[model samples]
Target: MQRTTISVSGMACDGCEQNVETAVETLDGVNRVEADHTADTVEVVRADDVADDDLHAAIERAGYDVSA
Candidate 1:
């Protein structure tokens, strides 16, 4: 598993946190995700094949921001 951290924004509450997490979780090879609203970031465990751009796009689509 590959451990990754992506800074995020627009998470104003726990519900928004879940929304961000769910977006990351849906990607193939994503084993786990922990979204922190206070920190405005997320930790992800995924396969080596997971693309960073895809993840960022997903988070944006879910109504959040993913740092490039």
Candidate 2:
């Protein structure tokens, strides 16, 4: 498994955190997801084959910005 920490913007509460987690958890190979609105970060534990772009896209689709 690979763990990735992604910086994200626009998360303001636990609901935003949950939105991000739910989004990322839907991707194939994603084993776990944790989002911290206060930290503006999301940590994902996923299979090595999972692309970072997919993670970014998932967060974006859920209505947030993924930082580079």
Candidate 3:
């Protein structure tokens, strides 16, 4: 598994955190996701071949901003 730290913006509360976590964790290559509302960061464990664009789009669609 490959680990990556992504900066995510616009998480207002725990619910938003859950939503972001769910979105990231749902990806095919994602093995785990820990999204912190206060930190505005998401740590992910992913299988090889998953691109950063996939991660960015997933978070954006879930109503957040991702820092590339």
Q: Give one digit per residue, the lDDT tens place, for model 2 in 24-62.
A: 999999999999999999999999999999999999999
lDDT of each: 0.88, 0.96, 0.90
TM-score of 1: 0.93
Model 1 Cα lDDT, one tens digit per residue, 1-68: 78888999889999998998888899999999999999988889899999888778889999887776
Give candidate 3's total backbone clashes.
0
Off by over 4 Å in 1: none
Better of 2 and 3 by lDDT: 2
Q: Which of candidates 1 and 2 is the stronger one according to TM-score?
A: 2
Q: RMSD (Cα, Å) of candidate 3?
A: 0.9
The C-alpha TM-scores of every prediction are 0.93, 0.98, 0.93
Pick the TM-score winner: 2
Better of 2 and 3 by TM-score: 2
Clashing pairs in 3: none
For candidate 3, the lDDT comes to 0.90
- lDDT rank, highest first? 2, 3, 1
Model 2 scores worst on lDDT over the 10 consecutive residues at 19-28
